[model samples]
Target: MTMTPSLPSFDLQIDRADLLEMERDVWNNASVPARLKIEDNMYDVYIRYRGSYTRALEKKSYHVEFEKPGIWNGASEVHLNAELFDPSHFRNKLSLDFIRDLGIHTPNSQHILLTRNGEPLGLYLQLESVDDTYLCKRNLPPGTIYYAVSDKANFSIKRKRGLTSGYQRKLGNMQDDHQLIHFIRSINTSPHEIPRLLNIENYLRWLAGAVCTMNNDGFTHNYALYLNSEDHLFSIIPWDYDATFGRKVNGDVMEYDYVSITGKTKNKLTTQLMKRSGYRRRYKGILEEILETKFNKNYLEDKVMDLHSSLRPYILMDPHIHSDIDSYDREPSFIFQFIEDRKAFLRRELKKL
Candidate 1:
């Protein structure tokens, strides 16, 4: 085996063990403000337990926020994604790269080796958090309303859960919900009004990315919706792709284009939009274009191989907390097989449209 090329890495050290202990307590499921140092630079941060059930695991994903500006490349916070599901640990990174290649606005991420109290914790995927800082970095105007969709966020007129729990507020006040609520109602009831209230092109591209990658959990949840203050319309952004490529969120193998022929999602608003022949055809066209240009199997395989080779050394030394590392090689190979099989499956399915 050869040594992999060096990439940007972060070495983290925290001041308080008690705060970390609180974070690790599954029952507490809480966050504590603490001082953290990354590569000798210190900052104020809130370390919080994140993810639905992933919090229960020994290796838990984290929501980390830095209060000061210019903490890290102009980022206020980043998601420390604990890749607990697949041993290969490149599923989320690979999927993000694929989506970005397709021109969808997904979070930028990199592999980071983390440590606490100078001891190696394990490999973590550091992802840009989607919030005001994210919007500012993109040159998007301020006061943009950001809503994080989850499994329960069906965009239904009838409320299933609390009005607040379904969608998370990132940038603006709770009053901003009126616009989104009205928009969701309009989507379900007055389907024809969609083209006026939403950024259809961006949503379609994101949907296309999800379909090509077989992200079963992406549509209803694992996505962000941003309301461009200027136009008052919404845009969809991809999130939490750890279950992408070949499997559903629950670790089930899924067929490519698992949701719909034209890449329509399980999202209620998305379903309503796909009812139109024009949108359906447009989705087919978008998916075809992605398959031809960005989602190339050879390109993806090369990318995956580079990642596999690069991470091989780290994987050998990784004290991974929850996953079965014995299957590391097998998992990456399965992902490769998924790309080839998914590409073929999508090609065949695209022809049906």
Candidate 2:
């Protein structure tokens, strides 16, 4: 039997009035000052509600920024996800870890318990914020990061709002926007030159990860674009994946065949890439490799079982879960079925490709 790991708790001390103010306006990005106790030490931090749609949830996710840099685990800022939509609470972690294992850039994450004003909140998945700190921690060269916030983030000149960009620049100046826009224009006009501007292998690996996990929201949005300062190449990083693995972001169960093998085609990058025989062949090879290794039912069974074993007790203690304990217990089987069904689907699709 796998031993249950001792979960760390974050005790937050905040003013009731401020907390109420935040709760009243769920869309407000303003943060309130608070003191957080972790183990034996206490740190002053700024706490704010995080996520879209999740803010209205009874158990809210949070974004925590330390007053001082490198205070907690070398991260100046962190995102504590309530994972309200995921019954298993392990899908996001599993997906991110799998992407990282593919040698792609992905945010690190762990599960932790949370409390506010001495009142127990619930379990949360703590994610390292992707910023300059992320690059520093990985010993990578300085780069600019852009978050694909909306469907308009699809690489195209014409957008829904008549805007040229749908990304939030997380780590760059206005000049970076010009560079990114040029790259997007190139994707349409000069598809063959994409290999020079983008890291094709890394991007394909991330695509494979998204496809395997069945992250229906991952293609055009729910991901980050990192432009390396040294290589002048853009690479993708996975994000916001709780709505994956046979479930929608609204917690609705989805059939294993929900997302197609080619993934979402709303984005021109993927459409243009797949049109070429070379990129298609490469992507198929990546899918085959991952399916043979990590994405298969046999390979993922232990991961699912181990995560369920460690999280089941804590999940039972959580008061915010919408599903019953029996439903939570059955999630592993659902995930395994998804793995089997998705693998078979992809195999057939690969042959057709």
Candidate 3:
């Protein structure tokens, strides 16, 4: 893999014991003073660079946009992963790039490498800070709601038991789907410059395509939904890509399982989502076109291969940690599973449509 001139040499040289101690120190006391502060009607926002279990050595931002950023961003906001895992393989930057290339909605980001003692320590993807002031000032219509996690919020509750446990909790809750459908219905009822329902469908299809492409760790607590004053709803912009691009180990090969698209209830909800007439008739073609154009197996293969190449050396130097990275493979069956299962659900739902 060709290395970018800007990227520093991949030379991580700390023993397992030393690494653990360092990790503890960093997690225990790794916070910086807030540069800017903003207050929206119901929330106080603070932004700070921090670390996480998923990406042990890196620094990323915590945005506290609400009193609580859900169960994930809890008071113990900064901590080391109980286990080590590779950060998203520059996944945020890659996802932003891939999404923009395919014409999807994403916040802007730039790549920066965080260092300690003037030596490269980890990579950070700096994103454009978005606050509710901007959302309110934009003049969104009544009943349109915008949601985000405040920096002080604890999202860890959702993931308390582990990744799967967190996902199950989210799936069992009707509130997510209820809120989502409510937004859709609001769009359907409201008068807007754009065809609101069509926009919603387009976003869903785009999100599905993104899942197929990256085999991403799909929407958990961090996904944000944005609604304009005009009652036009946009898809939730993806955040936290540290576990994307087929890099996860110990998972099923099926794309549906690659993320959290499992369980009978989620299956039913997914079926209902895809079965919507607007999604089935008007948006499926566009989704198919985009998938064919931007997210074929070859595309995913090339991208993953490139990422593996870039990160391979760093990973190899640490056998224990790198072994986890080596475990993931490009399984075509994953994509097929997603298509087949979603197709079956859609077919059943379409009969009613």
Indicate which candidate wins on TM-score: 2
Candidate 3 — which residues are off by over 4 angstroms?
1-3, 8-84, 117-120, 127-198, 214-217, 247-272, 300-353
Q: Which model is ahead, 1 or 3, in terms of TM-score?
A: 1
Tens digits of per-residue lDDT for model 1 on 252-337? 67765465544434468767877788988998889888888777666787888888778776777667732455577676678877
The count of backbone overlaps in candidate 3 is 24
Residue 348 lDDT in candidate 1: 88
Q: How accurate is candidate 3 locally (lDDT)?
A: 0.40
Q: Tell me which residue pairs clash in candidate 1.
A: none
lDDT by residue (tens digit), candidate 3, 270-322 = 34445456545555565455555655545555664565455556544433444
lDDT by residue (64-87, candidate 2, tens digit) is 999843468888889999997788
Give the whole-model CA lDDT for all candidates, comma-separated.
0.75, 0.87, 0.40
What is candidate 1's TM-score against the reference?
0.90
Model 2 residue 337 lDDT?
A: 85
List the RMSD of every prediction in angstroms: 2.6, 1.5, 10.8
TM-score of each: 0.90, 0.96, 0.51
Cα TM-score of candidate 2: 0.96
